[model samples]
Target: MRRPLIGIALVAVMGIVVWQWPGSDAVASAGAPRAAIASQPVANHGNWLATPTADGKLTMVAGGQLVIDAELRRLFDFLLTDSAEKPIRQIKDNARKVLAERLAPGAANVAYTLFERYIAYRDALGNVKPAADATPARLADVVGRRNALRRQFFSEEEANGLFGEEERYDRFTLDRMAIEADVSKSAADKRAALEALENALPPALRQARREPVTHLVEADKAAELRAKGASDEDLFRWRSQEFGAAAASRLGELDREQAAWEARLDRFAAERNRIQADASLSAERKQQAILALQNSQFTTQEQLRLDAALALRARQ
Candidate 1:
């Protein structure tokens, strides 16, 4: 197929705390000592609930009723932070306390068991590595092992709640990678593979994957046109045909911004050349003049671009 060397980022399933921006109601209720935890209207998709807390934050509710507590939140934060520095046993002990306080008598035991299994899954992933010339089968084997581990640790329903769509994502990625690596396959075959892979995905993820692929293909086409010295009009027409009016309009805006930036750079270069050629000025004075000119002409972002351009010119 001679497919492009596209980097596909594999999805990792981990238990992490999600933070959402505070809503108006949450903000208004903040600082109230005993604010009621309101159930936010979430889609009836699974055993999950969006419960708003008194501190203008939202926490996950498991089994659609059991509100996850501050201890669990603290544990999640600790696990995520690179600087946590606590030993594994200590971390587990702390998480146990949090889960114990939050969950019902029997439910707490199950939650703690699940927590331990989650940590084991993470550790297993860290230790797994395939060979340098690993085949599609090898990749599939790794994915299958991970899934098996999940199944061993948690029930099907529980697994789905903790790692939504992750298993499907792994399968999709593995299939795509295999297709990309098959040199004997035709472009049409590869396209078919891509279509099948995308079709298998849930709607939301399918759209997310498709948009980036579309953008990459369009960018490559644009680069080819640029190399062939196509006119701006020609580029606009091409983009419009490929991606539609909205994308073409956005590209036009970007082109105008770029042209303005280049014009300013040209002006700066001319002024800098003039300063350099002024024999009356000392070297230190010339440097100071250039600095002053740069400060006057460019905003922070523009200054960064100007500095990069100057560095590239110096290198050449």
Candidate 2:
């Protein structure tokens, strides 16, 4: 099977996005059954030509409860992409049309109702101000408030189904931060506490958290091997032995891309140093020369990151 070109993002310390929302006690009523055609066609729009990230299945469990999860969120986001550009009424109609096309009538109706409530909740959430402090206490307080607001719109089951995993992960992260920041704890105690926290997580969450760390460790080892004069074939064979042929191929591509990027940066730096060392040029002229050089070397978008890259280079 072909591997994905991009990898899933890994969680980092203080990297979780804080949800800000005001409280609301208005619960959305359950959707009622309505007669619908079996072959309902979606609205003819340019956006629907391609496959969506999520198919908007509106799946239910054996107990006749809706199964809410990240997939549902992805569907909602895909449908609501035009929210900023279009009026709410039109956007909702478009979403309903797509859902009706993809799902059974009863499920589509229920999904539509839930989508509306989600929109209302999100609207209220938009009014909340983000906390300036990134301290664990402040983050936890913000999460608590956001959950309170979420509960007012959804029942216990609904809220849990929709956001349980993310909430759990957030709590775990905050707890980890708190433990790491504790001044009195010895290094050994901190390690034990961190290990305990990791052990407490569900298997899926544990795996998710470990993947990025594993990748970083593997990358460092690969770099060491390369420093010892490992050839491309040697690296490929090593990576393949470790993580299958397909994954090794992808890693090889990544390695080449990184090498090419570094080469470009080196060339840029060499030319830059030469420009700076030219004694005949005035300060203004040198500045203009560097600006011209940057324009010639990088696109407008790439130029945005050039300063930060240069700063990091200087530190190194």
Q: Which candidate ranks first by TM-score, i.e. highest?
A: 2
Global fold similarity of model 1 (TM-score):
0.49
- Per-residue lDDT over 78-129 for candidate 1, one digit per residue giving the tens place of the 0 to 100 score: 4434424778788778767866665565666766666677666655654444
| lDDT top scorer | 2
Count of backbone collisions within predicted model 2: 0
- Each candidate's number of clashing pairs is 0, 0
Clashing pairs in 1: none
Residue 277's lDDT within candidate 1 is 99
* lDDT at 75, model 1: 41
TM-score of each: 0.49, 0.65
